[model samples]
Target: MGAEQNWIPTEIGPADVGAEATPYGLIDHLQRLEDLTGLLTREKALVFRGFGVTPGELDKVFDLLLPNRLAYVHGNSPRTKVGQNLYTSTEYPQEFTISMHNEMSYAHQWPARLAFYCEVAAETGGATPVVDGVRWLAALDPEVREAFAGGVRYLQNLHDGYGFGKSWQQTFETDSREEVEAFLAGTEATWEWKKDGGLRVAQLRPATTRHPVTGTEVWFNQADQWHPAGLGDETAATLASIMPVEDLPQSVTLADGSPIPAEWVEQIRDRGLDEAVNVDWRPGDVLLIDNVLVGHGRRPFTGSRRVLVAMSD
Candidate 1:
């Protein structure tokens, strides 16, 4: 089969990140440039400032900013699905950090690339971290990485209704139970529920998905979360009941019939934290990250951090 190398570069002049200068010429042109949609896309993110534009322009910019498969996205939209602390509780909404990850690793139809920008930098604690997802996955034992390539992965998203702390069923918008189940049951993936009425599920996917242009197999799943934790018998069973069991014929187990090692969880957390990129904003700042190679997250903040987001293929 032919490898996918279909790359479409944005028409933003010679804006090389490799350039030593700020590329003042590019910036000046970009500011007056009303619509960036033609210049943004599955190609690259054009981060510039001084645009006396409206949200409509921003929308067009987002459309251009996203990968061909996904649209431009911000921290709020993704976090709503994963989990995040709202600004209301924190003292400074601007002073927060974030992690890195693809837009929707849990969902089967994840975007191919991601991009982000910074509109407002906090006085403190708002730096972004990024790591190549493929490199991180390759660092694992060949076998362990191979197992992941098979698409056997899982995730646990807590929804205690902090803002809408209701169960996912209540949180997500859908027509009925069937729609909800269907939504949860990714056509390109599979999953099971946790016993605590939480959704702990897994699906099989390739380990190294080559970036269309980069031709790199990116690590795309959270395996540590998928493996079963042999907690107390009762607890395990309860967790199993609440978790999605359609694909997990047998209970999730470690390499042996042992509880999952704490180190693995720590590893995942450490990787997620270390590799993530964060941005504190001033409402209009649109951010984008290369999803195939990086992860993302938000830290605690104060006040209302209202942000809009979108993703596309």
Candidate 2:
């Protein structure tokens, strides 16, 4: 492999891998991945392509990759579930790019791995760009890096049932307030239920973390995604002119409540995209990534694109 291709995923086609283009072929590929011990951890990602894997056979392949298949708890984005623990990626309007970040990095615990399956490839420009966490961290300016030393504060403003942004019911995937309170209690986060049927939460989370296995610290938070500053000048200014930052549906600030400069967050967001290796999808392609070692995002696309994701501990 060429040095330029180092960040691209390790791809295996059915023919080259000597496996038939079917569900069983995916099993063969999974077995091969297992045989090549440390490949997932070393390469950080693997893409199985040209397998002709269908939606009906996806569960079998997913079970092999994510045995436990953890629930998407405390996720901030909107998505529709079409399968067990599998969902359409980030349901953000397709035109906007989803920025890079480690999945659930703000939570008390995060997934160790994430597996993605492409059931329908986009007609144009739909690619899941991935970046090495180490590379991303190195790309940030030292000032921005030091600014986050005390970590970050994440705030979520959930509506009761009718209002802008997600309702507490939809955000937590539950109708029971008791359950939501219990979940937040466990996270050691502050929360309150408003008389108007809204839910407000605030949590302090680290900006960086050491991988459990590799022990290498990496950039690991969604500050860029949560801050209005990173939402593009027009969008950020629009949101700012409408409401105060803390009143936004989702917002982030320094752990001490200091405002994070727009440019600082922009730098972190821009460089990650600049350094990423984009993985264009083909129907039936699956990508497996070590969640802590890599960060992923989406490119603006046109037409239909259905990508299902699952996670493992």
Candidate 3:
């Protein structure tokens, strides 16, 4: 498996780095940062292995990787903040697999880089499967690609402070309606307030984007995560039974106000996973990537696993 995903990073042990995996070692590497920066931009991902970094030294290591960290505002996934800016990876049950997505690709702005640090490794599975955006785009059926050519429409139904799905406060990281409204004004989106104290948001975003420096076209979007069809029939049916489609926590369709066929969504979900390169993790390992150039997902795992993630623009 490792040989097949040769694009994935290989372990860079302490001996290979010629220093212990400590704050000082990180600082020393930064002195010759230009070469590393060029390599990261070209490769899109890297992993620092066997660097026995502790929780207290995470800040120092992260500062080297992400100079100006950004808050996960407007994110839809379930996560818990365990430190100042660091957060636990998606909080889904261990039995389920998390599909691939570029960080905040659905938003008008997104993180340019991200770092994932493993504090504990799972006894089984729990690999971070990644894919080259170029490869993923190639693996898709031509018909599915053409269907999403125009773009996608994303709809989010956020509660005032109760009920299913994340509250508006958690999604926008604010309790004040004024702040939420202010933030939405800056994006290419519109919204309406529901009588039931829910906020219904609608936005049209591109299904693909080009990398800034490399100018590489990548299949970039979160339609799979937003669309009910991507979930199994049983789960999608349950959500539809409970509420109107528009009232669901999240939904998506084509940009021209037409339905996206379930088959299209299923192919997008399946092809991405089929072509992904899974990177099995070890404790104390840190995976860094150029967010737009790569898509990442979580595989099902057993036993305890703690992967802390943070991002920067």
Stretches of candidate 2 off by over 4 Å are 1-6, 31-37
Write down the lDDT that model 1 would get: 0.43
lDDT of each: 0.43, 0.87, 0.85
Per-candidate total of colliding backbone pairs: 52, 0, 0
What's the CA error at residue 40 for candidate 3, in Å?
1.3
Ten-residue stretch with the least lDDT total in model 3: 1-10
Expressed as tens digits, the lDDT of each residue in 131-180 for candidate 1 is: 45644564455655543444434333434233212344533443254665
| Candidate 1 steric clashes | 52
- Write down the RMSD of all candidates, one decimal each: 8.9, 2.2, 2.4
For residue 76, model 2's alpha carbon misses the true position, in angstroms, by 0.6
Q: Quick one: ranking by lDDT, best first?
A: 2, 3, 1
After TM-score superposition, the amount by which residue 13's alpha carbon in candidate 2 deviates from its true location, in angstroms, is 2.5
Candidate 1: misplaced stretches above 4 Å? 1-46, 50-56, 66-98, 115-123, 138-150, 155-166, 170-172, 181-202, 224-260, 272-284, 299-307
* CA lDDT, candidate 3, residue 247: 75
Tens digits of lDDT, candidate 3, 1-103: 2222456554555677686676567556655467765777878888887776667778888888887888888999999988767889999999988888999
